[model samples]
Target: MLKFVKHNLETIAGVEIYPIISLSIFFTAFVLFTVWAMTYSKETLNTVSNLPLNDDESLTEKHNF
Candidate 1:
């Protein structure tokens, strides 16, 4: 698979711009997604993975029980 992609990209562009373009796009998207997740994810890492809820409330409860 890699060989085929490399061969085609080199042949088409004379220097393999496809791989560079693909990597740039992937890194940009990954950074954007990480930023979005850190800023906007509803379930924070602290709350979801570390902190315990109060005794009066059950995590499965439909309301603030």
Candidate 2:
């Protein structure tokens, strides 16, 4: 089955560029996210980190299901 798919793909023109384009997009997004995370403010990070543990009534009311 794998061999059949590989043979079909090998017969197509311009098929090889798809993998290169996908890899480039993934690499670019990963780099951007890493940079953003590294530069994120510590104060904002602390507030976000504590959100789950916070017992504020307003949050629970606003998000009530």
TM-score of each prediction: 0.45, 0.81
Q: Tens-digit lDDT track for model 1 on 1-65?
A: 99997777667644657568999999999999999887975665544543355443455363332
Please provide, for model 2 over 12-63, each residue's C-alpha lDDT reduced to its tens digit, 9 standing for 90 to 100.
9999999999999999999999999999999777766777899887755654
| Segments in model 1 whose C-alpha atoms lie over 4 Å from true places | 1-15, 41-65
The numbered model that scores best in lDDT is: 2
Candidate 2: residue 27 Cα off by (Å): 0.2
**Clash pairs detected, candidate 1:** none
Colliding pairs, model 2: none
**C-alpha RMSD in Å of predicted model 2 compared with the true structure:** 3.6
Task: Give the number of the best model, judged by TM-score.
Answer: 2
Clashes of each: 0, 0
